[model samples]
Target chain A: MSEPPQEQPRPEAEIDTPPRGLPQPEPAAQPPVPAADSGAAPGPGAGAAPVWGAGPPAPPTPQRRRASTVHVLQVIALVVGLVGTGWISSEHFRTVWLGSERDEPVAVDGAGAATHEGLTVSLVEATDLGATPSLPGTDWQPPSGFHAWRVVLDAESTNPDLFACDVALVDGGGRHFVANLFVDSFVDGFEWTFSCGVPEPDDDVPAQQALLVLVPADAEPTAVEITSTGFSSGYIELEID
Target chain B: MRRRWMIVGLAALAVVLGIATNVADARLLPYGPTSSTGAIGEDAGAYPFTVHVSQAQAAHTVLVCCRFETPPPTGTDGVWVVVTLSYATADRPRGASGTGLVLRSADGREFPVSNRTGSGGWLAGPDIWVRGDLAFEVAPDALEGLTLVFDPGIQLYGPMPTQYARIPLDLDPGAVLDVIELSEEQILGAGER
Candidate 1:
């Protein structure tokens, strides 16, 4: 009844193209139905809804727009806000409880020396500074009920890069004391050298590194320890006479 | 269903974040030195040092603390409270925080040493008790149940509590005098102790 369909007459593969010599059909794939011809039917599947080119091919969807500068900036800000706050909070908690502090140290007797990172520290002598010892005109002095003592150390090294160390006196009671840094001046060669003989660049460490410390009257210090403040925990414990 | 789930997820996230913030502020945020409280004449021990508050006094005219009279009659109406204390450290307090003394009253009023001459913040090595005086200016009525607080001056990175010596001071407001001389910080030598 629908005048034998034009494309249906052709083979399946050749439906897309007809011979050029053949008379040309209307421009569109299917002719539009007139409003007056309401009784006319479309393709086989066409009933309440008539789909165009539903069997052979479908129309291409419109391309989507690209992301905008504002959208990208919003994403970046969100990531930064979340990551920054999380990192700070976690970092604060992480630093609170350090797992360990001291490590097994290398022990050396009197007249012996220890070295780390190319720098060497040695104990030369231990002298007793009697009760009532005072470095007059200096900001530092021995407190009451304590005896002052001097631990002489000699240091030698050619390297000063990232160099920091602490030399402390240990009493028989396990008390530790380092040379006081607040001493304004060196009175009468009474030096409390906390440097542990760290020499200046290209210069020799002073011959005698006098480390003065105050020990309690009950127990006198029998040894001294040297440690680097950096990551490496390797240390030296030198005995005193 | 999906929309309801999204709302529930967002609400859960909000509650979690609220709890996290509260916990962080209460335990994590504060770091550095620790502190504590004590009474006069008693030995209080803290990290890096041990302290004892020996004496406390109040005066209007303080001797050897920058000026002869703390507050000139023309100046603010306040009284001078001087504290004498000593502390010993087995460890070096190098570059540590809180060397000066602070005066805290019963009602939570705090006053620090104002005058620079012979002021607070003296430290020494182990076995040696470093004796010093710290003077503060406070209202005449604020002298009741005064306490001297000393922060052991530890500025460590962790949440290590700073050792604080809060030794209560007893003074008679009526006993306020016109002149008082402050003692110099002295390292107790043999007989000097």
Candidate 2:
């Protein structure tokens, strides 16, 4: 209203005029941040103020998309970490639990007999004729009446050389006696078994005495000994059945 | 929105953890496969005997002997003795078999002895051990004696005799004899339990 209407100002003339110490406006819109300003705090001479005539403001669509992509990457990282931890734990457990199954036999010296389900028995005996008479405690008593007595004798020779053993059963009366003496196979030494049945003496016999003795006729007891060194030097199981 | 997502994640994780723990437990827990039964074995050269004691069984002692020869090693040639007892009360003096019992050796072997003859002695079969089930009949009362002798086998070592003397007296009711000498003291002590 203050200016004359005859000379009308052109609408595009003001846009073309360059302002002092400022850039001309671009037709396309541009974001406020510069390449140098990326990831930096705004400063007095750097990213603080927007360029005077850079362009119209841009929409926030691209930035929102980038934020959503970052969220997806975080979820992927969490899943990978969990899987790695589980795999390591499983490997560790497998190494710790295991067992062995097998049967092993143990060997022992002196009367070695092992039984798994049922018993397996063996017997051995040795004697020296010279040592027989030297034994201590010479006492014996015979059972009364017509009694039946059975005795089994087994012997093995330890030395590579052959040997023989003689077993004698002397009745309560020094006059009557029974004897079983035999020579065994010498190839693998000697393993012999002798069994005898003795008849019972009369009940009226006065304080009868019985003595059983073993004598090595051909070899000494030192040459042939039982598997168990712990033996009585000579002991026998006496069963009255 | 963040809080809501966190709550949903936590709930899903809890369900997954519950399933994993339960699944592992179910897969790992079950009984093992080995079910063992009793089978007893006897010593190879073991001799069997039966004894009967009566008032007439006075004065002279009865003796049954088994001699063992020495093998190269003592353990190779050895013997073991096992016994069983059966009785009849004043009402019934004749005993029954099978009900008597079974005994075993150091190793697991079944030695079955029948109480067939109430007044006679019953020798054990070839086996040397008592089965776990029939062990009751061999309860200390059944034992008479155990003897072991080492003999010379193919290779002559020497003769050694091992004997354990045992007896069954008129055992007093409600009385027990702690057989301290049966084995080592520690082993007998543990058995007290």
DockQ for model 1 equals 0.28
**On residues A1-241, what C-alpha lDDT tens digit does candidate 2 reach at each position?**
5778897889967655544555544646755545353666744444333444344456779889898898899889989999988877666344433222222322222454322122122223222223213223322211111111222333222332222223333222211112222111221212232211121344221121222322212211122111222221232221111
Q: After superposition, how far is residue B109 of candidate 2 from its true place, in Å?
A: 44
Candidate 2 interface CA RMSD, Å: 23.6
- Candidate 1, A1-241: lDDT as tens digits: 5587665644656446544454444638755554235576553433533322234334543432233555688789989999998878666456644545547666554458876666667888877777566656555555555666777877776555535467777876566766544333366555644454346667544666676666666666778887766525577788875
Docking model 1 quality class: acceptable
State the displacement of the C-alpha of residue B167, model 1, in Å, after optimal TM-score superposition. Answer: 1.9
lDDT of 2 at B98: 38
DockQ scores for all predicted structures: 0.28, 0.01
Off by over 4 Å in 2: A1-66, A93-241, B1-6, B26-28, B31-193
Best by DockQ: 1
Error of 2 at A96 (Å): 7.3
